[model samples]
Target: MHAMNRRLSMFRSAVPLALLLVLLTAFHAAAERIQLDIASSGVRKLAVAVPSFANGSGNPNSAAGKDIARLVISGLEFHGFIQIVEGSTNGADYVVQGRYSSMGGQMMVEASLLDTAAGKTLPTRQFRGSAAQQDDLVLRLVDALVEDFTGEPGISRTSIAFVSDSTGSKEVYIADVLGRNVRQITRHNHLCVSPRFSIDGSKLAYSSYHRGNQNLYITDLNQNRTTKAISRREGMNLAPAFSPDGRTMIVTLSRDGSPDLYRMDMQGQILDRLTQGSGINVSPSFSPDGSQVAFVSDRSGKPQVYVMDIGSKRTRLLTLQGKENVEPSWSPKGDKIAYTSLTSGRYHIFTIPVGGGSPTRITSSYGDYESPTWSPDGKQIAFARKRNGQMELCIIHANGKGERTLFRLKGNQSYPRWSPRRN
Candidate 1:
């Protein structure tokens, strides 16, 4: 009996030792996978510094230099790829400084990127523009620095056009990625929805119900600033998507009483109907190669994602893990699709592969995240969420880290679209 009791005591000790080993191995594996995923997505941010830029226009310190610095800082923050350290902090990886030379009617600005520890300059560029063109100068310099660090063009110059109801009527407003230079693009006493950018970023096509019915209208941003109705069909014209070449648009129309996806030319002539009797298909997005289309459909008894071949008209379901998913936006790289899915009680943003895979949740604890729009580089996602009863624009890394608010507008903001890099 004594020997048996001793054996039992040893067994209990061995059991706990074995269990601890298993737990440690599992934890290590999880950490390894997380690191691998972050590296694969290139989502790790670099710590950099941007002190107050100096004025070189003989003023030594002017508001223009500060304004330029502020814009640059905002651009970097919005991109979410670099963390700007305070001037008081040290031991950073990189430091950026600037000198703004005011040229009377024009401004000449030079920005330099330096290695703080090594005390070496990484890259430098100078930009010149009229004083009235201050925004342009700052944007150009910022883009240069971005390319130096990330090897890709910055989104500072990219614009976002979305619907706003601040005027008591739904209208479209265009602003930079930093939410500055807000401009009212449309002032009609009508309702507009689904605003999209053309390939050249010179025109916007949206569905407006101002003329007693929903119709598609194109606003020319370059010439004459004119607006023309592109489609006056007998049914609801909405959800316009531009082709990669910008010569065609795939949209949803309910003229026949059922929402269906249709491909049309830039002139609104119907070229093909991609879906027929699909039970409310909408929000069609073309692939970057212009070979396939992804949209939302409820033919499966619930809203889910579907992709169709442009030529064969064959369809396949893309998302299976989520109960209901909608608002599919294909990334520019054509690798992933971002959409909103309801998990728990709040809506969260998720992304899945285009070829059908388990969806990865990107947002959590945020209030009703929706309408995720990918950046032109596919590195970050801009989305709208109602936090504290106010709609605001926020961005997060593609790998579900570095979540930050872009800015809070005066009124509610929704349906953000990040333009292609201008530089």
Candidate 2:
């Protein structure tokens, strides 16, 4: 683990007693509260079965079948209307089968989706790719099959932006959500992390250590026109939080040797310092209504989540049960905040009601899972999972079921923020 990852590991052991008390109280309150009983009805969940694909000419020990099937099923599972049937038993609403082929210096994959109930073919699609990436071609076809069943475009149309250092420099790269179209976004022979999209989705802001210092820079992604530095403070100008209205941002800076939260305009003008003397404040997340901010700080002890009223400067601790909590991402619906917690020496994503409640664990994998970012529709959470020394981005339904791997790039991928749907 890197130094930052190790710091997270230590936080799980250092939470305070007072916070634990608050968590117990909240749980009791929830148990006592009367809740409405709505009519019981369930959405028809389609079961999808993807059989292992035959590799035409590749390493027999490769992970092609599982990787492609996982990526495709993940996109369907995120929509919350489908369930991926594990194994090869073939008892499912739909079954997909595919094979790889190479011709004319290019690799091609052909796939077909069959309606198991009716025992007939429903849809078929073909994908072409570079001869070297034959497996990726199969995954893309799987995405198309998912779209045909759901009537909604699959995540294959979307791409993930992440940092990778396999080439010896930690630069940002954008790859298809299924791990195709792996294009380098930054060639700045420097370290770049925390890539975020602007409200319009045409610009990106990220922290870079390219100039021998940690600074914030914005790039017009469409035009490839780069802007001036947003912040170049002496220490740790990182974690930019864009406002919902798209006019301002809240960023963390450590210029004074203590990381504190600051609200800044889009043009890099400092608006106000919402926190002061709070121990190592970072990860500022604006509420859905844009009235308050949720952040992580080590003020009362170890890192814990705190919510601050934007106007009154009053603060309240949001997380009380966990020994360490960080990476708070407020839901777009404004009712809850999702974050990562270190419990039992493993990092997992959890969510608490913004009004206060027992934090619900969203992931229970044995690996270190952190950085929970909500989809714009507030129905899914994308996060980074470190399992077996390989780091990959995974998405789970906000309802706490249907976990699937979004993609597995060459290096560690973290800090996923979904873009709002464009008109």
Candidate 3:
């Protein structure tokens, strides 16, 4: 009996070590498979070639085929991790090709990724949708291709919410990441700003001044476009940020004659007062974890980014290099906070570590960039840039590369906020 007990104990001790070895081996394999190191400071975009897709009906020059290839290449290059080269070049690491066909108003597409050095092709992925959904189908395929190479999926289907004055008044609008399928969410005709989406992307909240006062409102995106006012306090109710769990929100309320940060439920019931009587605290952005929130405050005599512990309510300033910092946006990874900093009379996008460090300026052009919002994957930031007396939406990589205008619209657009990953 004693010998048997000793053997059982030894087995239990060895099992943990064996499991640890297996886990290490799996991690090493995954790291080797993905060649792109997203954290590296240097720009090392993977060289890839996306050839014109072929029509299965024997017409290689079909317009549908060309359209699909164009959309795929553009979507992949927008992420900043992959560079679409012309055809399969000498240094190209991978090649993407596909075939598409239309039948009975439905489109069928099949795409495959080829490993250049390995001289092999991955299994083909097939997609089917209405002919009008060709763009969406290609975007999904590019997302799948990205996931096949990297472990994480691309944000091809994500949308951006912003306040546009195209209709002669500031109203809320939503557009896809590629700037297609633009939809107006609010017809307030007055002024609407700070459009924020719930974590699940099913609801949107914004502050509108249409009813003669700045009031907070929520809209159910999944329902029949019902708009409900959640907070109509006497003073200002603006910049509502949904928590990570989507059950509560942190907003700036000035009902008591001073703009302060308050935690409130979805139904506009105040749960806890986060900040009171301090310098004007507004633009509250919750950390990825529900434990902390990064917001803009003027308590230090200048508007700067500050983070507070949700439980203890202890706050610490984050930006030190900028004179005035506002519109704090917490990254999805919870490592950095992106905000707009005033420099040389111009507002530019900058990011600072959550633990208090020197801010890193992201925009260097002759323009004013503001309202920085991190992508769902933490790889990019969408913001509003005013250049040459024109305001437009722009996106920049988290590492400060690949800065470009996101979309071209008729009128001015501002306060761009990226939605969370779709369900």
Candidate 4:
């Protein structure tokens, strides 16, 4: 377990348009065909096509190639497995055909694909950057055609990390998954929140109060000022999950007074302690074979949603009907566990079955949704709702069906998290 020099340093949310086109038509209704099993099933769809996109640099009938083929058909119809067919390609099974160029100031784009049943022509991919990273060359040609028809790859290249007070404070930002550039990684002008990310997404830990100590930092998204802190001891160096192989991390320290859940690393040390003071153990996640850990406990009297098992430290009770469950997450194929329950007093989002079952409701509207997360290919989810008082950041489709609005910015945005699809 000897490691260091794992640097990173780049940190970078928004929502709104007809109520965001009725939430981008429920985020393009997710899938219609490609359910490789579960991440909440109900799949199928691949009509494809993309009609406009061919402007070797001029106006040869290319309004920026029909706006880069409507941003590659709205980012491969929001990654549920595509369906955007218009004008022709008869009943598509794929068509894509791209092109773009912009001299010296840089901007490449290529693309190709085709094969409406062996009319063949595969392998193509160009890309190039800097035209303000035109959505990073259409999310790398729509996540390289969804990793050439799903073998994996296409979280539109990935990036999320949230919490924004629109600059009056609550810093810590980062955006991308088609929500565009938007950086600003904690100027710590005060309150910063959760933020996780690291398992090859470079690094980004987070949990700040700026120096008054709510501590726990880590920033490095590749290098431009480096963040550090690691776990400034005191009363609570909160949130941090990481651990799918980027070394170790479970986090949620109360500096021994009680908050619980430890087992850190990647330099922040403290390698053990998995919950002890009896109650309050914050949001920790993991599982996908890190041996287990879902988190958010109230020790069994109230706050629910547990899991734990990291080497037999045993624990259970996973929200049996929620009288208030907290923020669980864990679902990059460890089967399920979404969380954020509550019920009549507001809050929504659910998901059960991580070897258990029951809880389903994935938010049916009415406002208050909480800090959910997931989506390093576990289909989708990125929460934080709130209503008339603002707060944004949304996305769905982990079988809660499509649902949209994931970009637009103003005075409120909360926890988010995402990141890890940058291979």
**Candidate 3 structure quality by residue, lDDT tens digits, 116-217:** 776777778788899888887888888877766665778998999988999999899999988898999999899888888888998888888899988888
Better of 2 and 4 by lDDT: 4
- Give the alpha carbon lDDT tens digit for every residue of 99-134 in model 1: 887656988878887766556675568888898888
Highest-lDDT candidate: 3
Candidate 3 TM-score, true structure as reference? 0.87
lDDT of 2 by residue, 154-215 (tens): 44445566667768787777665556667677778897777777877777888887889878
lDDT of 1 at 90: 83
Q: Return the candidate ranking by TM-score, descending.
A: 3, 1, 2, 4
Q: Model 4 compared with the native: what TM-score?
A: 0.39
Which residue window of length 10 is worst by lDDT in model 4? Answer: 11-20
Q: Please provide, for model 4 over 1-423, each residue's C-alpha lDDT reduced to its tens digit, 9 standing for 90 to 100.
A: 011111000000001000001211221222223554234344346678888877784453667788888878878877765678898879987788888887778889887777667666667888887887776677788877776675556777688888799979988889876777788887869977877888887778777777887887888877834567887888777757878887888887767676788888878899899889786777778888899988876666666778978999888887788566777888888899898776766778889998887889887887878778888878788898878889899888887876677887988988888887776
Q: What TM-score does each of the candidates earn?
A: 0.86, 0.70, 0.87, 0.39
Candidate 2 vs. truth: CA RMSD? 10.2
Greater TM-score among 3 and 4 belongs to: 3
- Local distance difference test, candidate 2: 0.71
Look at candidate 2 and tell me the lDDT of residue 254: 73
